[model samples]
Target: MILPEIKREGERYFLSSFKLPDKLTFAGQPIPLDNWQVRERIEYEFYQFLEDQGESIILAKRTGRCFPPAEKQLADAGLPDDLKYMLLVESKCVAAAYSKAKASGPWQFIPSTGRRYRLKSDAVRDDRRNLEMSTEAAVKYLRYLKDFEQNDWFMAMASYNAGEERVRRLLKDQNITDYWKMHGPRETMRYVPRIIAAKEIYSQPEKYLGLSKKDLYMPMETETVTVNVKDSKRALASIAEEFGTYFLELKMLNPEFKKDVLPRGTYQMKVPRQTCPSRCFKQDKTP
Candidate 1:
């Protein structure tokens, strides 16, 4: 099988050859590759993702850990499975990703939007940094956009990148509902295609990434538990000790917490299976 041409020069890698397939689809809608402008737009995004192998490879590794849950959420929400790629384009699956716009988490939701979606933020917790919570919010938000865009997934995705009001105004001004024909902000124009680019390259990673199964980063298997912190002054290190885990491991498992000290709340946490006894842990079935 022929692969996308890749060449390494010193420390950098370049994609020397890439061809647009005759057909491509995003969120179950067929991409108009026959249109020269659309083809070029797609090519631009392809290069944006593939030209640097380091970022591309890191993204591929992250996809393994991040995509499955989001994909499942999309499926459950009855949305297109391909919609998960939006997260990849939004934050490259970085849980701690924070934008200058203050969009946080792999879903890249700003504080106001995050709160609107029921992703609460407090001194002790930011649900935007919690992968599961943020993904759930993203699914609901996309569903709303999909309905608002009159079931057009492309326009829905565009609305996700650009505000819905702007997309609505663009549709009214341009008198077109077609995402391809309607002109919008430059970044908004590129956003959907970037997501499509991620889908294409990641769907068959070996074609672009040349990575084996072992090369990908797998999600850690852990059991979810409910921990009640009765003392506001108790540090996470103390809690970690109670669970037979180190403070760092505890923090790594629950990235939502903003501080090392507990704030007297009932919190759900994840830990290695068998690390804590059943009496000490309350199994959470919330997924």
Candidate 2:
């Protein structure tokens, strides 16, 4: 999609006549657009997103493949549909995504956070890299934060970017009730506005960036099978050979397994059901 360009002068770039929508809502709650500070912050991020159209296109394309299942999961978990954009904002919906701070996966859970939420990260497996597991962990954490923040989704989202206790302390100490009003770290300050701008562009790609829903990449038709295995690596190789798929295909589909060996217990595997051969059966009996 061709994105709008920013014009520049001798010292600084500008979107001179560009302006944000008259009103905006995030996660079913209205952003206080009457506040010039709120409008300026969100507009700044929108300009930033426009400045990186190449990367934004990549993110939008990925959303096609990464969004559906997680969208369903979010709906099932009773989260607002717009919150799905958090995955995009967090890690660009990349399962292999890793940040400099050691946050990993689409949900960007740091090691300690992953452990607290039962997302195991070890030599053999980092559930933080697993889409399903990490997504559940994110939702669980969001829900907990929501409750703690007195059902305010904005506060929960801010705490997600910043530390929960830090935000809480700021809120209490400053006697501030609004997330936008509370002072926090730099990243936390920009986090919500970034997500809001992303959601706007993503949902209306054609309007904003000359791209349609057809440009999105949805997941392929696949099914998950439960199988008991002794060795992860060897078992995957065997399964790949049996199904006429590469080890990487299965590996990509199941990002939780970090080691070469598949574990001994029952594990769920996603396979392309239609394209897989009839002999591509679930492996309940291990050799």
* Number of the top lDDT candidate: 1
Against the reference, the lDDT scores of all candidates come to 0.83, 0.80
Quote each prediction's TM-score: 0.89, 0.85
lDDT of 2 by residue, 1-287 (tens): 44455433444334444457898998889999899898889988887776676887788888888877678888988988888889888998889898999999989999999999998888767889888788888888988998888888888999898878999898899998998897878899999999998888788777655578888887876787665676533567776655545688878887877765676677677766644244344442233
What candidate 2 gets wrong by more than 4 Å, as runs, is 1-18, 231-235, 263-266, 276-287
Clashing pairs for predicted structure model 1, backbone only: none
Tens digits of lDDT, candidate 1, 1-287: 33345653444444655666889987778999998889889888998787777889999988888888987988899988998888788888888889898888889999988999999998778899999999999999998998898999999988988889999999999898789998888989999889888899988888787887678888887788777878756798877766656789888878888898987778788876663344243333222
- The candidate that achieves the highest TM-score relative to the unseen native structure: 1
